[model samples]
Target chain A: MSPLAENSGPDIIAAVIGLGSMGLGMAQSMKRAGLDVVGYDITPAAVDRFVADGGRGAATPAAAAKDADIVVSVVVNGAQTEAVLFGPQGVANAMKPGAVFISSATMDPAVARDLAQRTEALGLHYLDAPISGGAAKAARGELTIMASGSRQAFDTARPGLDAMAAKVYELGDEAGKGAAFKMINQLLAGVHIAAACEAITFAAKQGLDLDKVYEVITASAGNSWMFENRVPHVLAGDYTPLSSIEIFVKDLGIVQDMARSERYPVPLAAAALQMYLAASGAGMGRDDDSSLARLYAKLSGAELPSSTKEPQSL
Target chain B: MSPLAENSGPDIIAAVIGLGSMGLGMAQSMKRAGLDVVGYDITPAAVDRFVADGGRGAATPAAAAKDADIVVSVVVNGAQTEAVLFGPQGVANAMKPGAVFISSATMDPAVARDLAQRTEALGLHYLDAPISGGAAKAARGELTIMASGSRQAFDTARPGLDAMAAKVYELGDEAGKGAAFKMINQLLAGVHIAAACEAITFAAKQGLDLDKVYEVITASAGNSWMFENRVPHVLAGDYTPLSSIEIFVKDLGIVQDMARSERYPVPLAAAALQMYLAASGAGMGRDDDSSLARLYAKLSGAELPSSTKEPQSL
Candidate 1:
């Protein structure tokens, strides 16, 4: 009983139900890996863009999932994920029986477990797969996936997972565990980025060159993956949204909620959440997350390096 | 003229004014470099240990400073650094007129500037040099030094600096810049460690294996130099103090003060300081800084992996 054999034909038909940055890149990766991939997005421009990039595009989630052997929901949050799967014109009923549904949204682990049980009852496999590494890695097919599911769900999602990820951590045989792991990553990532912003702006206030601070820190114990990746943007004064301030505001909120449910006191994550909220509330919601430094600078009255272009509205 | 020439007859008499972990390793590095080095500590046992390690020992700051061409003050805080340099029977009045003072204590930039001015007024040079890379790197003579001073101060301190550090960042031609850079590093380092502890302990609460969390995080974007360095200690349940919780309590205290003086709000460092303070208040002050995870674990009521040995007092 091959997982792919559940479809009408031998070929695996994959449908990516989000054509955002991560989803579009992952759709391209699957297409480039010679899988038959169809992508869909609520925005027509994104769907057209995916189609223009030599991949098939669908008009709706139901239409895309009508024959997909694997349906990957790469949307933003639990609400969006649930809407795509169980709302009007939802994909769960559209997906073939025994097909796998890979949920890659960052949501509560409890939500993932509930979705897995619901989808399993519908005779569809659910693998809780949350991703890390940003847009560039997603496009290059090098994202890290923390995935968990039953054996059959893992077996079903393996092909698409292998095509899209450089590393896939099979965390457990249950759906919520992958989500748990991702929350942990988000906790650290959020805190590190906020810390980098705080330190760099503090350095700027103390009259240290931002570039020099970046150089010294990356070579020292203070360095983090977020610091090394994002501080360059601060040094260059680039606020282009590689990842937006709102993303962390959302993710760290989820982290705090999870921690609260567990009665875990994550003071650092809570602190980081406040910084993200500050940045977002200060009209930097859509700016590069590195705009955190700008928030710090604005609050401290410190001067940062000018950007290469005219400033965007704060 | 060579700074070494300021000492008697081609011998560069170097004195290490503290014999704690970092200071002891640095003293050994200088001794291995063949400088005539003398180490001093308030603790007689520490001084005896240094003597047993084939290094000369001094009973007081004056005895260590007398005739020394380079005096490295590797004490704990601003007050201690000031005491070693200017207390009753202090080093300033005992050193050769042209001798250089290399300050490795993490302190306020203003204090470093003031000390440099005071030392220069006494016909001595001062290099505001603060070190990073913990005891292991110090032992291998591979520490990173963020240093700033006058050209002559840098020139005067070069021999001792070269012996103890693999990388020397000459930040500026002023005394405070090095301390400024160091405070920035401490801000990031302290926050990263707290974030790592928060993430690992959160994972533990989620029932994810901590060792796996450590493995995944190091390979993920959540990774930091402190995370990679300190998390293994948490996994091994080893609370042996490579660095202690109190170190961050002091360093982040400096960071918070710097931020407050600049009117900069550093929420992440402030939050991290609270975690360290909480850990210290919980009586884990002398344990490894990674004991932060234990603090989180205790607070969250999560069971951590057992250590190979009997538990130390919390």
Candidate 2:
């Protein structure tokens, strides 16, 4: 029988590891759905914030995993995910047999399959569930998840998935399918953001108003979700890091690595990755990814719309 | 006094030069709006089609310009626009003085300014009015025009602009601003198409279905206007050139030239231009712009979804 079949009620316990921006929001979403939720983070402040928000906080991943029916790992990348599940003070062996472990990091498909196999060997279900929609959607329980796993794993995680995501695309019955889909999303997202920056800064170079460029492009054939979402930051001259340049540096790097392994040439994504690397190296890695416009302006000596404050350098 | 002010009536004679896809539709739209519309094209068949669609056809550029109050040049680029205006049998000295000349070609801002200055010297008002929304919108009289020029130029062209465009963004009181805005739009459009091709092909490499990638991406942050509009062609394996890859080679070539003049680095647009150039070199230049996906698949040895017919080679 499945763990969900065994529970058969609202008594399922869920633990959320890596309670940072995305994880804390997911923990709150689970708590709102009436699951007994425990949250842990490497940063103690994040755990304390989650506890103050009326969820349980655990000191370690193992403590959080103890007796949990589902453990959702929302870490940064494959390394962090592996550390949380199989590192020293890891939670894999601590989770009850038949429990589902959901991996929500952007990772390589090969790495995802390896981790899934390791989790299954320990009598736990592994669902490859990489997320989209950023932290704002995470807080609203309105994320989009590209997920794949065994039938039993889907059945076991459906309730929590419902609590966390507005749309959960069941891509396949394999462990790495979701990760592959996420890599594709990241590839487009990263490229679009870089393209937006390039176009807007080019507009700046030509003496067109950035605000007007944003207005016209949004209603024209050139528009993208990233363009509409991120151009405002450039127009307002804010680099407050809703998503950072470093994120694309990491995500598009993963895309390039995977493409290399597959012998595929992703020239657009590869080009976009270099822009993010340029921005990150210029000490704006933690700023809003829209800092790409600033980087372009600095390189070309074009004046952008004045910002409220000078951008800080790392 | 402005030509429109002298007339102060509904009577205006408009000629559309270069009756290609966009120009032909725009000519039809002008006729539908009850203007005295005349059209000319280098291709005799295009002129015949315009006449069959209930518009007058002209034998040459001067024939189209004779007695016309507004002349709209919807040619391919700066060269074509200049050819139709100042070449042997050009129309610069043929149109009535104080009549408007609307240049709808995507050209460099400096070239647009030069054209505007030359037209003004010939006692014709020049409006740098480049259009968007493609041929369908042109036919519906629902295009978006990014326009700038002298007040008299705008006044003379207002009636035709109303008949042809749904939104006319008055960008500035100069001749180059409209062209600048159009270049910005082309930069994004070209890059987004290339990005879409890269992402979809990467998905194919990962063994994900292209149709499913299309579905998921259209609903995800990865989506762009080009992705939503062009991926259908890829999915159906139809490359019957709604817009050809060579168009980007020209358009993005303009973008690069403008960027080079400004000493601005447009890495994304540059990268996208390379993809389009590669496609063109591989004999898919006249195919749909989405053939970048096919090129990537060929390069990586990945099979795409079965098409209705085999892709043709040069």
Candidate 3:
């Protein structure tokens, strides 16, 4: 679908129902864009932190949605999204009729479509809007959002989208397309990151200079954005999670589920999923994704820089 | 080692002992740089074609090396390189003493070191150089050469390298260093190509707009140089061989061998190699490396654009 045209609207009261790193940054971005933002999170400390940062906090998602013109669900998956909308004190009955719900969780496209259907039945619009660009860009209001929904949903969510995204691809006039596209991106991302880790660690195994390998590769055809972005963490031996290994374990697990249902043979993605699983299984689940290199290092007894605050190994 | 410094040579003559696309291009590049270049190939037609392209052609490697100051062997692997240097009518003894032999084949590092020892024992310089940037870059003298050798070897090969390479990385002062780096690159390159093919065809199976996927992915973190360069071929359904599947089969085979000997587990490269092998076995051995997409399409019954003169599917 062609992207929605440049949109404008009257005052928007936005409810951000999850003040994690990504959601908090997105909430601040909405406030900066002149939206009256209400934040809520299951963690009271998180809600307190958001309120301390000068945004109002709500006792529950339902409370946050009560006065919201748009409710942005920035939770992790379909289950959490469903809970926020239908659990005790759910936002479905609390929000005004015609108020839009924007789901930014990465979940099964089928789940996204079903959520859209249920939300529409409740006299609300649902936008399947899965976000990219991580927390830093989230804070900068420069996220890339892949979204699909009806024209009414687009109109209702325009203010939040404009505030939160640098690029919003309006995929279609229905849900699921955005989720499918996000899943594809996730598949490639997972594969590329694992490949990069494999390359760097294997280079280390060969006793070649890691920095030179990085230089030559970035200048050569073997480079990916993941390699360029994540290798520094490996080189530093840092395992502090910029994006953890568990994220890919979950994302690629979703891909495997989706591909299996479709009977699609995604050999590369499947292979990549194994690497993430192995890394997560090796107890690096919460470590940076580049820790796949550390996994290889541990398995092969190939030494990487032990320059991290604490050394990471098997 | 730092790249060979700029040097002046007195009437240097170079021999290119391979008239394939890459060798012909390198020979032409050398001739363009004012080096008198003579070319040879196993296929008489290739030599004839080179002669037809305004070049001198030799009957054999020895004949090509007879009056040369630098011999560049741009063959396929260590075995071919050994044949060029020591087989019947080999170039090793035929070339003048002190003339450098530059081996631009991807091979195991141990094999490269062995070949370097043999060449050096014959009172000659052996520069372990494996090339990148495909035929177009070779034709334009813009190839990137990862090279390592003695200072004398660098000085001896400098003129031809200046003509043939846009960037020559002086990896170290050893013959195997270049080969090691090249293998690392091949490991990543092969994996990326296979991953790109898997991603696009998988995207196709999901009924995505392939063009839009190309757009979104190139803008997203999932992108690799291979994906950006190769997916257009899939989008157009053209499996015309830009680089054949067999190339990766051989390269990744070498990687498997190296990693096995090193006791390093290269699961990602190993996985990628299987896809290339499967594609080759499925009769795409000479088709574009991107034909992995064709394989996925065949296996999953995914429909891609059949815009090519010939449809590509099982």
Lowest lDDT block of 10, candidate 2 chain B: B1-10
RMSD of 2: 3.9
Where is model 1 more than 4 Å wrong at Cα?
A1-10, B1-10
Residues B1-314, candidate 3: write the lDDT tens digits.
11121133438899999888899999989877878788999999998988897677899899999889899999999999999999999999898889999999999999999999999999999999999999999999999999999999999999999999999999999999999999988988899888888888878887888899999999999999999999998888788888899999999999999999989988889888998999999999998899988888888999888764765444
lDDT of 1 by residue, B142-257 (tens): 99999999999899888899999999999999999999999998999999999988888788778897878888888998899999998888888889887899999999999888
Q: Is the docking of candidate 3 incorrect, acceptable, medium or high quality?
A: medium
For candidate 2, list the clashing residue pairs, or say none. Answer: none
Tens-place lDDT per residue, model 2, B143-246, is 99999999999999998999899999999999999999999999999999999998888888788977778888899998999999998987887788899999
Task: Give the backbone clash total of model 2.
Answer: 0
Worst 10 residues of 1 chain B by lDDT: B1-10
Q: Tens-digit lDDT track for model 1 on A29-94?
A: 887776788888999999999888777788899999999889999999988999999998889999
Q: Sorted on DockQ, highest at the top, how do the candidates line up?
A: 1, 2, 3
Q: lDDT by residue for model 2 over A1-314, one digit each (tens)?
A: 34353235458899999998899889888877778888999999999899887778899999999879899999999999899899988999899999999999999999999999999999899999999988889999999999999998898898789999999999999899999998988999999999999999888877788888888999999999999999898888878889899999999999999999888998888888998999998999999998998899999988877678875662
